[model samples]
Target: MSTVLIVQFIALAVSVLSFGVALWLYTWVKSQPSKNSRVETIAELIRRGANTFLRREYVVLAKFAGVAAILILLFIPHPIWTGGALDNILMAVAYLVGTAFSALAGKVGIQVATIANKKTAVAAQQGIKPAFLAGFRGGAVMGMAVVGSSLLGVTLLFMLTQDATTLLGFSFGASSLALFAKAGGGIFTKTADISADLTGKVELGIPEDDPRNPAVIADNVGDNVGDVAGMGADLFDSNVASMAAALVMAMSLDNGTPGKNVLTVFLYAALGLLASILGVGTAKMGRGGSPTRALNSSTYVTTAVYAAITALATWQLNLEWRIWGAAVIGLLVGTIIGLATDYFTDDTKPPVRHVAKASQSGPAFTILSGVSYGFLSVLPAMVGIAVASFASYLITAPLGAGYAMFGIAMSAVGMLSIVGMIISNDAYGPIVDNGRGLVEMCDLGDTALEITDSLDSAGNTVKAVTKGFAIAAAGLTVIALLGAFIAEVNEAIVTRGLNIELLTGFDIMQPDVFFGLLVGAAIPAVFSAMLILGVDRNAQRMVTEIHRQFKEIPGLKEGKAGVTPEYDKCIDIATTGSLKELLPAGALAIISTLVVGFVGGVHAIGGFLTGNIVSGLLLALFMSNSGGLWDNSKKYVESGHNGGRGSDAHKSAVVGDTVGDPFKDTAGPSINTQITVVSLISSLMASLFLTFSLF
Candidate 1:
């Protein structure tokens, strides 16, 4: 084998082995440690104590420094063992640096949080509106730190390996800085979004007359700054999904030469940022009552970008053996786990008032409403994943055979992972919070409370479903990484034997036949749209039922002032129209992916897929936050604008929030945390797969 390929294989092996050992150790420690017997079993106790110690800040720094030193020692060129030590050392350094960078970035994140707190104080004092990005300035700071560290680390690694250290170091340094800045920014952005969700959804409550509402302001600061900015950081800085694109780009480079800019770093970053913004806007679609189920815009855009990038790298740039088929399989398995979890946990049962307010249309409406509601709540996310995956293939037609298929598989995994988490969180949070809100009211009798209590239990199940998704994501990420490694190894063996026909089933052409491709692309959108409409219709039925119940209750009369039918109708209209608005996002994804694919060739599919998945995840998170902020803002604004405190308007704000538990923070940040972990797994898994082929 050539020296470079030999090095690549060695590096890949080391990464996979090291990661496996670390993961196994972590899991074993977690499962075996006794909570109550903290001081027992000398060896086991020592191991537990050691792990705890390692997690400490100073200890972590020392470990990182030690790993760095080891890399420097081991990366030296040698003839021993076929000159493979250099490759293994290089791979080790990559992991060590990545780990160190992540740790340092976290410290920076803490500092950013402090700054946000200070800013919030200043804003409160100055009577300025609180903006999400003021807090997100911390994320920017973290991004800058990560970028700086990554650049320095990569430059040093390169310097250690090359003969013309001075010249190569300078060029590599500059290029690494540019790439790291963008990549680190994307990471920090996702972290920031998670942090914000942690604070906004869990730590804080909806305030009276909050200015963050979307309806009152033409340019809501939260949506523009908090949601968009945070998402941008996540996609650019933290996302592993982008790694596949990066690998494809690197593979296209001329013999690993340091000269040309192989990657379209700027363009990809822009697309990633766009995905984040789109994600924020589309988050509301996940809500059961909102219009449109086909999938969020983020997924469409991200998948397209990933595909386009891969296609360009392969067909136009002539890159080869860049796709990870096993990773795709692992992802599929994980998605199935997530979907099963969501299916059983989802609650579509009628509320207590359903019987009292039953429509003359009878049980048929009830069943339809239940089915519609369930479909609406879940279908958009699923469909979005499917569409994003299929569209990625169309965008990679020119990348020869295997690459396009791999892109689709990766996209499918990425999008599904994201959607599963969002649905899980949203479904769980509302019900729990709604119940908590009722408890806090102290107005309901034991009987009414009991009914709501049942609703709350159902909500917990929803939360469990989300947890199941998280479990699946973590499992799949590991599996995908392993799968990708195995596939690469197998492919290498086949190539060494000069065998071309040993590749597995269902290559790139399966999803690309005229009707098949169209169907694949359209199905998600169509299903999602149908689901959204169904949810809306179901919600209207419930609202009408609730209204009738109130009217019929002899002793439980409506107050002199309550939301009028017209007001309820307006809410229905807003939600129903949202789906139609969401359609444009999917359109953009499809159009953009196809256009980019046609021009760039099939390998560009990697780029489009990466972009779409990143976008979808970001969008899902953003939309949820934005929608919540808007809901809260509207409540506060209406209360203040209609009249001062104690007015019916004010009361409504209190009651609406209290009853709905819209933000779902009443219990804790668990739901937001759930989504955050999901995001983290996506990034980690992407990295694993992308790096596994070549370390």
Candidate 2:
């Protein structure tokens, strides 16, 4: 076998090993004790609700995938009539595989997280250390499963098809599922969260996670579906996109000979997974260790491990040093972005505390302060992205004029090399968030409450960090995808024997490019608005439902012994609304891409991707940070600052949190997937756009 094939097998081995680790972690989390009947009952409810939402979502998405498959078979790469039926068949099958893998990764996360949340709540009665371990280990399952599956899928697909373009079809499939998983799950989570807080906290002054609140269970369910499943899908897409883009470029650079570059991509990706496995294995906390510190420490360990091992491999395997530098640059910048997010979102940090202080003046001041700090927070991340992308490009430009973009793609790969750990940390957030709720509702002693609160708080900060990290990675991945798009367009041009000059890059001096840029920038805003509005409309309905339950269900509001609010009703509303609203926003993003591509051709798409990247990054950063700021500010108040819970300031902060719920959880995070989806769409449709466009 060629060296490339050997490296491919090695990458495959690493992926399988990661899956083994995931299985072990899942077993470990499952074995953790869960003794509280109340916690078990409620946990089962959350579990059931989450599964219901995911099942319905998949059923709908299956229809979508089917239609997409037909389209792929008929038109993608070449018209079926053009006598490329074999390639078209491969593309369709790969696309289906991509969607299936992404969905399975998400399902794995939900299954483990549901079990972990219950165990974490029960374990909290013992102490924070055990609970932290339970949550982290559970989340590690998702982390391992996602990165493992992406690597495995990419490796097997390439080995089987030996075609780089086929990977784009697979990526588009992953994006299709992710767009819904993120947006749909976000809408569901925020709908329940906002309603719970509004009816329970603001109006009736019930404690957070109070069982009497009808929306409370739905809120917990949202944590699993949105944060666990949605986030897992989002990261899965990013991982796959980064690899697909890199491979597309790598194959071109390698030119079918013994190829070091492709080997480097697979090996680095495999090693990154290896590093995450090590990091997760060592993840632990002392009895009184700060959960935030433990999580951050494990992340740092993973980063260090990846860097050291990749460097050694570069030397031993004769991989290009410049590419290594680019990858490491991406990794370091990702770490820096996470720290910047932590500063903005951590309650101990001034931005969050300042927002909390502003809440004393009422909700408006809270909003103003959070928004200000949020905008400021974007500076560091933007600078980090700029520095990483430019530095990687410059580092690799020495190799050849054509190598710079590939270098950037490598950087994204490097940055996400530890995504297994990132996903673990992220999934841990909602698991512990559910744990915090369970403890409160079960009346676990104040001791357990304090432990869970600390874990949940850490989860929130880490989640903000991971969100920043994920968005930054998406920004890098899309830049790489842009490169991949140009590569695809040029290949298509060659194959079609186009009379026109081949595309090197987009020139914004052209009118079509400018038009696409303007339109592209607007899409993020429009997409964000649609998802947020979905939450708003859905939340209003849920709030009304909540009020109706309290008014009609005797003793529900009073917490009467035998009277429980109908949590199923709230879950059903969130499910129905999320399914309804998700498609329109996703459709808008996608349909607009098709419109722009058909209208302006490849030049417009180049500009379109550019504008979408710039504004999408900005809005995603601002909304995510500001939402985190508001959320932590409320937590800061509840932690006995600003007159503690139920005070006027606390109430105002609750309102701020409500406003932020959708911003961070729904629209903000979803933009990453939106950008990726459009980028992949542009790549997949490159040939059609070139051949058919009016421009």
Candidate 3:
């Protein structure tokens, strides 16, 4: 066998090992003690609500996926009458495989997270060590499942078809699922979150996660659905797109000698997963140790391990040092972006304190300060992405034609190489967030509540950083996919014997290109608006329901025994409302891309993607950071920094946080998937656009 095949097998083996470790972790979490009946009852309610939402969401998604599959069969890559029927079928199947794997990964996350919340809550009664372990390991299961499945799916598809275009099909499938999963999950989470806060804290003056609140259980369920499952699907989409984009560029390079580049991408990704597994295995906190420190330490360790292993591989395999340099640049920039995000969102930082101080005046000041800092926060991440792309291109330009673009693709792979660990950390946030709520509901004592609160606080801090990292990786991935689009369009032109010259690049001076650019820039804004509006409408409905229950259900607000508020009703409303609102936003994104491609040809589409990425990144960064700032500010005020809980400053901070809930959780992160979907749509339809576009 060739060296490439050997390396490919090794990557596959590593993927299998990741699954094994995830299983072990899952079982270990399950084995943890959970003897309290009240804890078990609350946990079961959360589990049931989460599963019901997922089942309903998947049912809706199935219909959407089926329609997409048929459309792919009919028109993608080529029409059926062009004698490409077999290829179309294979592509459709690949797409289905992608969606199935992504959905499965999310299911696994939800399952383990629900179990871990109870375990962590129970363990906290003992101490921080066992509680921290339960939350971290539970999250690791999700991380391993997501990265492992993405790797295994990519490798298996390539091995079967040996076609980069088919891999694009699989990626589109993942993007499709992510579009709905992220949007729907985001809306569900924020809707529940906002309603819970509005009714419980603002109106009733009750503490968070209070059993008197109808929406509290729904809020906990939302943590799993939105953060754990939704985030897992989002990263899965990004990871698959990165590999698909890289393979497409690599296959078009070195006079068709794509083996070396393919092997290099696979090897780098596999090593990253291995590094994450080791990092997860070693993650631990001593008695009274900081959860934030433990989480950050594990991330640093993973980065170091990935760098060491990939450097050794580059040296031994005689790969281009320039490509390796590009990858390193990406990895370094990703870390820098994370640190920058942490500065803006961390409560210990000045940004959070500043926001908290501003809250003393009013909610308006809180919003103003947070928004200003949020805009400032966008600069570093945007610059980092630009630097990584430009530096990678320059470094590899001397090698040969097309290598520069391939280098950019490699940078994306390198940046996302440790996505396994990123997902683990991201998932860790929601698991512990749920644990904190469970502690309150179970009445596990003030000490246990405090311990879980600390863990949850760390989870929130780390979540902000990981969101920045994930968004940056997606930005870089889509930049690489733009190159793949050019390659795909050119190949279609050549195969069809078209008279048009190959597109070297989009010229900014062209009218069609500029038009597409303006339109594309508006898309992320419009998409975000639609989602936020959905949350607004949904939250209003749920809030009304909460009020009705409080007024109608006697003894509920008086803390009378045997009179629980209607939790399931709020969960149902969130589920149904999210499903309803998510479809239109996702449809708008896909439809607009198709409209642009068909309107001005591929040139217009190129400009469209460029605008989408720029505006999307800006909005995503602004909203995510500002939202995190508001949240941490509220936490800071509650910590007695500004007037303590129930003070005027705390009330103002709550208002700011409520407004930010949908901004950060619902619309911001979903933009990452939206851009990826448009990019894949452009690539998948390149052939049709080449032949059929009017302009």
Per-prediction TM-score: 0.36, 0.99, 0.99
lDDT of each: 0.31, 0.94, 0.93
TM-score of 1: 0.36
Q: Write the per-residue lDDT of candidate 2 for residues 393-507, one digit (tens) a residue.
A: 9999999966999999999999999999999999999999999999999999999999999999999999999999999999999999999999999888888888989788877
Candidate 1: stretches off by over 4 Å: 1-83, 130-133, 143-241, 244-261, 265-267, 270-378, 402-487, 494-501, 505-695
Q: What TM-score would you give candidate 2 relative to the actual structure?
A: 0.99
List runs of model 3 lying over 4 Å from the truth.
Answer: none
lDDT of 2: 0.94
The candidate scoring highest on lDDT is: 2
lDDT of 3: 0.93
lDDT (tens digit, per residue) of candidate 3 on 383-469? 999999999999999999899998899999999999999999999999999998999988999999989988988998899999999
Ranking by lDDT: 2, 3, 1
Displacement of the residue 288 alpha carbon in candidate 2, Å:
1.6
Between candidates 1 and 3, which one is better according to lDDT? 3
Per-residue lDDT tens digits for candidate 1, residues 200-271, read 222233221112211111111112111222222222122332233233233323234532222322222222
